[model samples]
Target chain A: AQTVTQSQPEMSVQEAETVTLSCTYDTSENNYYLFWYKQPPSRQMILVIRQEAYKQQNATENRFSVNFQKAAKSFSLKISDSQLGDTAMYFCAFESFGNEKLTFGTGTRLTIIP
Target chain B: EPEVTQTPSHQVTQMGQEVILRCVPISNHLYFYWYRQILGQKVEFLVSFYNNEISEKSEIFDDQFSVERPDGSNFTLKIRSTKLEDSAMYFCASSDFDSGGPYNEQFFGPGTRLTVL
Candidate 1:
């Protein structure tokens, strides 16, 4: 079984600044996928970004990017130019090569200060 | 982009009563899944369905829980006897697959909050 851990339970960032949420995982599977999901006050879980294990190149989606360190089993999300709307609960997830089920981290509550 | 849709944003049910949650996944997706999140807890996987049968299930999904794709569009999860512990937000997701290929990214629906009293 794979376990994902989000070390930061809560984080705060000023508007227009950058913040990073950290996550680490334990998995023996060589191939897998990593994902970041955001749940705002509305409680809608939205996909923020994704990273393929085989891809060494980091994935960048507009203001959201991931620093995936496969060797160290770390995948952290970086939010740049944060806005008030960026405040939300962020979850890190892992999916094994053949599995469709996603195992998620505890989550980090991020607050963007205006 | 198409998305998964779940009905009845919230439900209140008495203990021992049967409750069914409904979802309509993306039209082209073939794999369906059910997940639950207790308030302030991490999301947990309940079950996964494909080819009109169950492909995977978690220990939490006991005999009381069952899933069925009754029609071409609707996927349903039925709990024969609801328990207080069953009260949580249930989310449905779906993914597209071809042949025997590994499952790809899953798209989630707005969860249904189930309150068992």
Candidate 2:
């Protein structure tokens, strides 16, 4: 079994500033995938980004990026030039190799104060 | 890009009654999944379906829960007897094996909010 943890229950940031959300995992599998998902007030969860365990290079998607430390079991999401729309509930997820089921963390509610 | 879709944005049902949530996964997708999130809780996996059968399911997916693809397009999750704990936002997702192999991504639907009273 695998577990994901998001220590910060909530976070706040100002517009145009950057905010990073932290996540850690406990997994025995060497090969797996990590992901960040954002759920807005509408309850629609959208994929923010994903990182492959085998690839040492962190995954980046436009203003969203990740700092993946495989050895340390840390994968943090960095939102650059954050906008008000970026305020939402962020979740960290883990998926093992060849597995489609995702295990999610409690979540971090992020607020972008204008 | 094609996306997964779920019907009935919200549903209000009575406890002990049956409720079936419908989903239409991406047309070309081979894998379909179900997950649920209680208010302020983490999203929990329910079940995964492929090849017209369930490939994997979590402990939460008990005998009361069942899944089916009655047609070529619609995939459904049926709860025989809804409990208060069954009240949650259910999400449907789909993915394929063609995008440079599996685990590329799973596109999620808007989700269905089930309220059991």
Q: For residues A34-61, what per-residue lDDT tens digits would candidate 1 score against the true structure? A: 9999988877688899999999999999
* TM-score per model over all chains: 0.95, 0.96
Shift in Å, residue B117, candidate 2 = 0.8
What is the TM-score (0 to 1) of chain A in model 1?
0.98
- Poorest 10 consecutive residues of model 2 chain A by lDDT? A38-47
Worst 10 residues of 1 chain B by lDDT: B97-106
Query: How high is the TM-score of chain A in each model?
Result: 0.98, 0.99
Candidate 1 accuracy as TM-score? 0.95
Q: What is the DockQ of candidate 1?
A: 0.65
In the range B17-41, model 2's lDDT, one tens digit per residue, is 9999999999999899999999988
Model 2 ranges with Cα > 4 A deviation: B98-102
lDDT of 1 at A68: 95
